[model samples]
Target: MTRLVSYDEAPPEVRRVFDDIKRTRGVPDVNNFWKALAIHPPTLERVWQNLKQVMAPGALDPLTKEMIYIAVSAAQGCEYCIASHTAAARAKGMTDAMYGELLAVIGMAAETNRLAQALRVPVDAAFRAAPPPPIPKA
Candidate 1:
């Protein structure tokens, strides 16, 4: 792994994003993920900005969003994200019971997803949605 950037050694661009992250999350320092991304300041800033917007409370409550993030992270097998989002969820008032239930749901979903894939299950008409918009050319 690349060296994690320290705040004292960071350049202006990294420092700006780091400062924002620290302020927004009310943390003494940004986590190792941000530290790693610090090597690429543009990506660090972009991800930080996007995370702030997406994780902010809106239609769904903060705890709900955090749990959803945890579920997706678990499914992707991203250990770091799962751990990080779990902590965030706890802070957002996720009790032990909620965590247990979330884990059960994640496990069941994973099992069913794999089984469906292996069986080549067709999508039910009622469960199908309209196609998404075309991706924009980069």
Candidate 2:
């Protein structure tokens, strides 16, 4: 039988963090991922803190960040992350049309990345030997 850790069964430190997360996020209970991470409370706490801080409104707009997240998840083929982040992106103001386009772009990028990897394409010798592009004049 599959085993899952109940929040009450979590380690002391994990329980603390889980309680805080429940209070802050207004969730009923922790998910399986966190329950597994609860085996290492410090790592769980650190990851939770970092995720909250990074995902909060910041210099990069939340929707944009969510788009970036969705793109990365799609590239990595993380179905759970793609679903979650896509929902987050929609919540942050992504339209259906925008989501469709975002998905198309990610798909194209993934295909190109795979092609590049498969061919082991090397950089043009001249491009590699040349200095970086000059900055545009103001």
Candidate 3:
């Protein structure tokens, strides 16, 4: 059981946040994570706004962003975040094949990262920003 405020019993400020959450997510239920954060309304609002900005469409599509969130959550061993982001990714049209591929890539990247860290490999100059492409002859 959470020590934080419950959505139904939350104060006006918290309820306003909850209402915004419902409207934005189009879901009537508030997740326990949000309810737990309600203990500090300011933090709750700040996090919600930040999430909105970060998750909104931009260079990357929402599905890709959710997949990245899932990857990071898995790497950090945050089961709650992994579960939530996996569901979000699936809702955004991720398939079993894509999930399998994503996990494979994540595993490979993790292994390579660990190896590089253990060996203290220096990043190659070639990997740095390509020397400004030779200026085209006017």
Candidate 4:
């Protein structure tokens, strides 16, 4: 069903990408996305490298990054990305409770964002600054 070159039938360059993917993920299986991308070796390599750099540990933890990916994917209505990120999140130790809470928060935020946009809500001045601490008792 794939319109692109299959993994086993790929050229050396594409095969190299597949090998790297296997080693990086520590899994023998390559997903359909990568396999489809093999038709264009440069694109496949570029995408893989970018993914590696972006997903690597930084200011944000891997799990948090995955959750963010899921949220954005959901908002964008990208079912493939959502499912992919959800699985990655689970593999990164996301619990069922955390997943449920994540979805709830995403839904609430989306609804409120739409409501705010519809009403043309202005930014509240109070929300722009952190609250000052209480004065110490004498």
Best by lDDT: 1
Better of 2 and 4 by lDDT: 4
* TM-scores, each model vs. reference: 0.90, 0.73, 0.89, 0.85
User: All models: lDDT?
Assistant: 0.93, 0.83, 0.91, 0.92
Poorest 10 consecutive residues by lDDT, candidate 1? 124-133
Q: Which stretches of candidate 3 lie over 4 Å from their true place?
A: 1-4, 130-138
Q: Candidate 1 residues 1-138, lDDT tens each?
A: 788999999999999999999999899999999999999998998999899899887879999999999999998999999999999999989999999999999999999999999999999876687677698776
Query: How do these models rank on lDDT, best leading?
Result: 1, 4, 3, 2
TM-score attained by model 2: 0.73
lDDT string, candidate 4, 1-138, tens digits: 657677678899998889999999999878878988887789999999999999999879999999999999999998989999999999999999999999999999999999999999998998867688787676
Query: Candidate 2, which ten residues in sequence have the lowest lDDT sum?
Result: 1-10
- What TM-score number comes out for model 4? 0.85
Residue pairs in clash, model 4? none
Higher lDDT: candidate 1 or 4?
A: 1
